[model samples]
Target: MARTLVIDAHPDATSLCAALVDRYAAGAREAGAEVEVIVLRDLAFDVHLRRGLRADQPLEPDLVRAQGALIAADHVVVVAPVWWGSVPALLKGFLDRTLERGWAYRYRSNGLPQGLLAGRSARVIVTTDSPGWWLRGLMGDSAVRQLTRSTLRFCGLKPVRATRIGVVHGSTPERRESWLRKVSDLGRSDARRTPDAGKAMPAPREIASDAAV
Candidate 1:
């Protein structure tokens, strides 16, 4: 069975992002995948990388378990909220502190990066109050690019997919439900594919649009 890890990067468990994580995990489990979740708010760990890879900083117990989960997963799903055209500080801190140099990636002899977390796929879901045009045209999809290209892909998670749900501030309850269903469907679809199968899947430039907002 495929193993999937869902990372809830929202600071508040009552946020919409958390609901999305729950729905996605439920869908994956329903599709027969073994699902694991890492709720950043619940984990006890220092978010700061004080040494900046220059010195050794021991991993906290929760972070150690998180790394183990990442190592065992075939797919990784990150659910976060966009703030100031980027992900929350908590999520950024998690990335900085968790995806370390020797574990997630290492420098090649030629000074290039060799991502060790190869053979895995990823999906990023971000919620924002901004309209699709503003987030894409003005913000240049900063949060999406950071998670999908700069981080996950840099660590060798291929075929990274992204979904944006937005204008959330005044969105109707029905619209929220629609977004939840879409995310759930995405989870089910992703769970059906094995790691190798994911390599063959053509990633959509944008899985869902907030143009309707």
Candidate 2:
């Protein structure tokens, strides 16, 4: 069975992201996949790297364990809202600490970085009130590319993909339902991917199924 690690960045366990986690976990479980989850808000950590790898901020116990979890999972899911067009502080800090050079990646003699976290897949789920068009056109998904390509995939996780749920301020009932189905579908599909093929995994909404949320 595939093993999956879900990093929940939302502060509230009762949030929509948590709902998706529940949905995906359920789907993967039914598909015989083993799943583990880390809720960032609940995990104690320092968001600032402080020395930026010079002195190097010490890893929080939670971060250390979270890194270990990442090392063990076949798939990694990062769920959070976009604060100021980027990831939440909790999630960013988790990455900063957990993905230390020697652990998650390494700089090669040629100046290229080798992704140590190879053989794993990754997904980024972003919740926002920004208009989808505005984000897609103006932002160019800079954050997702940074996290997925320049970061996660850079560290070896394959097929990294980003999904955005926009206009969160007040979505229509139908829209909300659509998003729910989106989550459930993603869960089902994640259940089936090659344990390590996160190479641009499609967002749950993009992988729609007939099932109701």
Candidate 3:
């Protein structure tokens, strides 16, 4: 069975992000994948790296466990709200501190970075207060770059999918329900695809069974 790691960066479990998180997790779990959650609010770790990784901030025990889940899961699901046109500081800080340079990526023979977290797949579920597509164009997709192109993909995670839930500030109950269904469907699709999600992964890549976590 596929293992999924879900990271929820929201401060409140009753928030819209959490609702989507719950729905997606249910759908994914119902579709036959094992799921775990890394709720950042409940973790005991410094959000800021202090002076960056050169100082080598130690991962808190909870964050370490979170990293372990990240290492073991065949698929990752990240949920958060849009703050300042990007993911909230809670989630970004988790990425900043937990996704250390040497742990997730390393320089190769050609001075190019090779991602070690290959064969893993990921999806980001973002909720925003603006209308759909407003942030992507206005903010120039910095969030997408950080989550999809830069971080997750940089570590060799393939088949990444991202869905944005927008207009949340004034969204009606029906709109929210519709968005919930979409995220749930995404979870199901991802769960269904996990058996072959790593078909395109590089050979000899580390899988959940091979991880020390």
Candidate 4:
């Protein structure tokens, strides 16, 4: 059976991001994939990477379990909100502390970084208050790119897909429901696919929202 890990990066347990996480996990479970969820808000780890990569920092108990989950998962889904053209500090700090050198990646003799977590796939779902066009055109989709490319892919998660649901500040309940269904479908589809280690990373897929700016 496929093992999927869903990470909810929102600081609030009651946020919309948490709802999306719930829907996704539900779908994955319904599809027969074993699903595990990591809610960053509930984890007891400090958000600060006080010691940089140069020094050895001890992992908190929660972080240690999170690492084991990542290692075991065939697919990873991250749900977060875009804050100031980037991801929240909570999510960023989780990555900083978790995907450390020698664990997620290591430098080669040629000075190139080798990813240790190859063969895993990922999906990033981001909720934003900005319109899709404004985020894609003006803001340059920085948040999604940061998570999908600079972070997940850097750690060797392949073919990472992205979904952007937004204009959320003024969105109606109907639109929100549609986004939840879409995400659930994504989870179902992802649960059926096995990660192909040789496949090249494709461009991130954008799931547009209907809410007007």
Regions more than 4 Å wrong, model 3: 196-213
What digit string (tens of lDDT, one per residue) describes model 2 on residues 152-197?
Answer: 9989888787788878888787877688778767866877874544
For each candidate, the alpha-carbon lDDT, in order, equals: 0.87, 0.75, 0.81, 0.86
Q: Candidate 4 clash total? A: 0
TM-score of each: 0.90, 0.86, 0.88, 0.90
Q: Write the per-residue lDDT of candidate 1 for residues 179-204, one digit (tens) a residue.
A: 99999999899999745334333221
* lDDT-better candidate, 1 vs 2: 1
Instruction: Output the lDDT of residue 149, model 4.
Output: 86
Worst 10 residues of 3 by lDDT: 204-213
Query: Candidate 4 — which pairs collide?
Result: none
User: What is the Å distance of residue 85 in model 3 from its true position?
Assistant: 1.5
Best model number under lDDT: 1
- Candidate 4 per-residue lDDT, tens place, 89-176, comes to 9999999988889889888999987888888989999999998889999989999999998888988889899999887898889999
RMSD of each: 9.9, 9.9, 5.1, 9.9
Q: Give the backbone clash total of model 3.
A: 0
Index of the highest-TM-score prediction? 1
Give Cα distance to truth, residue 110, candidate 1, Å: 1.3
lDDT of candidate 4? Answer: 0.86
